[model samples]
Target: MNSFDLSIETYLSNIHFGHFATLSIQAIDNLYTFKGLVLIPVLWWMWFQQDECHEWRREMVLATLVSGIVALLVGRLLTHWLPFRVRPVYDTELHLRFASGEIKDAVLTNWSSFPSDHAMLWMAVATGIFLMSRRVGVLALLYTALFICLPRAYLGFHYPTDLLVGAAVGIAITLIMTRDAIRVRYATPVLRWTERHPAPAATLAFILCLQLVTQFDELRKLASGVMKHL
Candidate 1:
């Protein structure tokens, strides 16, 4: 790590000031992994059958999912192909700079720390929400940065550069997915196919979501391993 990256990593790692704050950050860390997916339920609850933009919202949600998947893939490839870096808690040099008695999970091992998959997912959804509604998007972006991003950094699961690069990848993927050319060339055809076989499409989406929530870690590790060799 360079001087700036190490400095920020050191500063963030020392942020678990008190017991209450430590507990809160830990809770946020757990919640952060699913913050993006949480939007799915919110959209479902808020979706209106007669709304003029109903189709837009529906399409945006699918686009967000696809973009997140693309970001995940890109991040995994970079992480595996790039030089490996250690997490703060596991970094011998950085551990000395960490605040003791807070958020040290044994499972937080040293790994490829150039980019964070968690940030990619959260930012992808945040960007998608922005495209759908400006007000909600602004709020969501702030919420993601403050709650999800900060907690992960404070807890040492990612470095500042990791979060920054992951978010850039995420925003890029979502922006590309938002492009008219991509939508016309790919998304429209897929949407038309789904419309003709709504039941099957819905079933597949449901199954994919179910497996994601239940076996996320397992699948992620497997994907990383597969990507590493590819």
Candidate 2:
């Protein structure tokens, strides 16, 4: 809890956009809930667009997905290994002014907030898009900042540094994975298999995307329950 993170949270928590507070909060909530679904179309656009480098683009998409999962796993592992950091709302020192309609999640109260998986996962996807198309990638990054990361920060679910580190890790992994040599060596085989086994590939893709959309909430809940029984 450095002064920098505290300052940003303090400033954001204090301001409520008078007449638009409810509407703004609703919009942010919706963005958080549906962010993964929102990215699907953008990724589809990148994949299916008429381009000479069709195969490369397809390979890049697989690499991006792999990077996102890897980055998120790294972030979650760090949360468990590093000294636990509490979210701003849960920090007794902060006394954050809760946003209208933003109730704390009892389930997440004990979770470490040092590095946000949200930023890590989405930034990786955004970086991959940027690798393929600069214009759309820029928009994706901005949307991530404003819609995804900012909402979490304002609502006190994460500190600014958490988002920054997460984004850096995500972007670095994505950049490395999308390199031509790396994609050709790893992603190319996966793409070839998908081409050969279309039905099973589609089924698996649907499951993966479903997990992404829910941020693995169901899987986490099941794991938590199992741990309790043990």
Candidate 3:
């Protein structure tokens, strides 16, 4: 109704209309599936295995995972609790259904459309990974943009602006949490504790806890899928 909403609606309608959207939706979703779930983690593990930052790696990994989860949850809450923007597909007068049956019904999510969750989660993980390695971060961001963010727009699930804002929120959260001063301040007590304790055991326990938390969503999804199949 206001200028911003009007602008967003107009933009969504414009982008959701043709051959481009058809190509982008499928392409982006597939990219998200492959890059987010498979490639990034595999690459992270490979790199992490060879990492020399033994002291810093565990701390950074813990910070990244915790901060990333918080960012994702905040983003989801903001999108869901704020104004409920409709997806382009449901705006019938807009007539933006480009290709029929190309998108999965499960993906045709009925949630509020502003601030896309896929974009938020991808950006969060990308930001977290970026804190570990700049080169890897850049690749992660590119993967998010090309495969996750772009496809959401193409598939009529989100406006370009939604992805942009979601990404900003994700990155902002990561930066706040992983800033050097914050890290030093938070890690000081933990470091002191480790100094008086078995450092390796403490670090291992910390990493295991983080690994479990980080994989929670993926595991839940996998379990749900398995249950449905059964």
For model 3, how does the per-residue alpha-carbon lDDT over 1-230 read when each residue is reduced to its tens digit? 34664465566445544677565566546543444564346334633464577557656655665566676678768866898777665656665553333344553455677787666766876887777778877888887787777666655667667788888887887788778889767655665566578678557655644443343456657877999999
**Most accurate candidate by TM-score:** 2
Model 2 Cα lDDT, one tens digit per residue, 11-86: 9888787657657755765554547777656876776777688888988888988888898788889989989888
Residue 71, candidate 2: Cα error in Å is 1.3
Candidate 1, residue 84: the lDDT equals: 84
Best to worst by lDDT, what's the order?
A: 2, 1, 3
Q: Quantify all predictions' global Cα lDDT against the true fold.
A: 0.71, 0.83, 0.64
After TM-score superposition, what is the CA distance of residue 99 in candidate 2 from its true location, in Å?
1.2
Global local distance difference test of model 3: 0.64
Tell me the lDDT of model 3 at 100.
33
What TM-score does each of the candidates earn? 0.83, 0.92, 0.67
| CA RMSD of all predictions | 3.5, 1.9, 6.0
lDDT string for model 1 (74-161, tens) is 8778888988878766677665445434445544554577788777866876788788788888887887788777777776777888
